[model samples]
Target: MTESPASKPVPAREIISWAFYDFANSGYTTVVLTTIYSAYFVGVVAAELDSGEPGSATLLWTLAIAAANFIVLISGPIVGAIADFRASKKAFLFASSVACVAATALLSTVGPENVAFAVLLLTISSVAFTSGENLIAAFLPEIASNKNMGRISGYGWSLGYFGGLLTLGCCLAYINYATGRGLDATHYVPVCLLITAIVFAVTATPTFVWLRERATPQKLPPRKGYISAGFGHVLTTLSHARQLPDLFRFLLCIVLFQAGVATVVVTAAIFAQDVMQFDSQQLIILIMVVNLTAAVGAFLFGFAQDRFGSVNSLVAALLIWILAIAVALQASSEADIWITGNMIGLAMGATQAGGRALIGQLTPVSHNGEIFGLWGLANRTAAILGPISYGVINRLSGGDHQLSLISTLVFFVVGLLVLLTVKEQRGHAAAARAN
Candidate 1:
């Protein structure tokens, strides 16, 4: 007899391999989107465009991010559904990673005059990165039981922040070396992009080699193509929204909170540079501090998640986010920004780890991909909404990024309110019944 998913043994090797994917991919977000390339695009690339609007670079960058996330928003659920039906989550993950790595490496060719080129590459890589992210997350229910999902998920996230730190550290070292040699960003940023891609490729290799695909292929309906079948399955899952009330409710909450999270992820570097007058090295150091704290937060919160419940942990995290935003709004000196960034980092780590764990707990193994696809759908939707909203606010506020940041508070506050409505026990019970 085939083993039930819940009873299936997850080897330690597989868990490590799974976690390594997070380790590998964190570099992309850290180096490209959050630290090096984003600032390069705004300060150097888009500046060459000679756009009269002070916020044009920020707007363009957010548009690129939003555009990529929009693609993921449309395709992520379908991809997950297909991955579940075909038992090809790993294959899909590999494809997405390859695309991301390749596109990221090619970003080295872009120059100050290549605004459109830079945006195109950024969009492609972002799509691949987000898609792979969703695919990897689908592995959670298969590799972990509901009881310890928080701890295990926390392992991946904590490791991911460390990975980001490592990547940022390497890039910072290179930037310092290049700066010492009197090289401009146009000369050095490309190399940093290449470094991020190489690290991503090297670190992610273990996941492809060591991680096992545990999903069993489901029978397809006669005459239906995989794409159509995938859509049908997604629709069928959506049709049962009422049955999984808590899960759906939690997803709604994710949409709101993730908006705040997404805004911070894509725009924090921009804010640091534009508002705080932080140079490249100082900006990197600030982010590295955030990464270290974020790693610690994820590691500790994982245990807290298991002990205290996901909802409670998440509530605490969101409350911290609100507080961080308050601090950020009034931030004046480097000291104030440091405190705010650390607060944001701690809350970010706990929020991300807690949310993913809760979803894993609430999700049935049988539809891990499809359900997490919906989770991805929520995330991508937030990604699209959040950064774009921030950009719009920046534009409207005459390039005042500080004013734009207040919008993040709304997402967290409202999301927390909605989160209070989701009964955690009911969510777990619903998943058990579905299984």
Candidate 2:
């Protein structure tokens, strides 16, 4: 039997390169999904279609996000399987990155009148973005040891927040300059999208250059095509999931908790803009601060995860999320939101970093890509359900952002309860045996 790549002496450079992908991709989420374009779409593009109705625009945005994530949910496992069979993780990653960058850049062409165009481009870019995210994550177990997985994953996530911060900062500077000269969202927003694309393209290049394809290619079975094989792999793996009970159980927790995280990722700016009357400048600043706190949280919790345990670290983070949501629900001023949002930021980093590390710990090295694809599936499932749920609630409440926001609390609480059942040591032992 061939040795798994997980046992290879992975260099620090490969790990850093792997982390840089996180950094590279963060701009897309920060500028396009989280900070700039989501609010712009809500306040401008879809608003034009809905005659400035916040609920309708919000719903449209969430629907577009849900649609994109739905595609990811269906395609992720298959793509991962194909990459595993063909040893084409880098190829798939590169292709997805190109698609995402090009689609995001073309977003510069979307005007207020082009609501459908906006949604179409957003869906394409979002699909590409998420596919790439899953592919990159599939590299984690290959590059890190079980003991240090949390710290390594934390490094990636912390760097990712910095990447987001830098992207948002540059965009904010441009926004300040453009608005200072009397440019409106029409002129300035396009430039921000273009900037995000350029940054994504440039920053992500190092990942391709430095990251090695460690998986050995598997020979195709007689008469089996890659696609069919891919589907077969997914079904077979899922059928055997009971053997890795803790991993599957944790995936359920991811589905539940990640719903809240996804909702916040897509809706934070919209919530602030609509509920707190935050201007674009204020929104960027708020998110930048959040990014800073998130980075710090990831860094600190990385060590904490190693010292304590993945489950414990994650539980602490979820509790913080519950508190953040509680504060957000009752927030009556910018200061209140600032406080709660930063708390969320802290928890966001810890939860994401800790969760990925735990998955890395629990996953068999040989099935790295396929398993992470399921991770993506879990996350994409949350993305689909969470934002749509929030959108529906907001619309039903007649654009009540506060009420809609409260739904996130339920996911966190339930997720926390589910997480407690994940036997981390048992999961790790199972993966080690599989190896």
Candidate 1, poorest ten consecutive residues by summed lDDT: 1-10
Candidate 2 local Cα displacement, residue 365, angstroms: 1.0
User: 155-207 in candidate 2: lDDT tens per residue?
Assistant: 99999999999899999999999999999989999999999999999999889
lDDT of 1 by residue, 393-422 (tens): 998777999889888889999999999999
Best model number under lDDT: 2
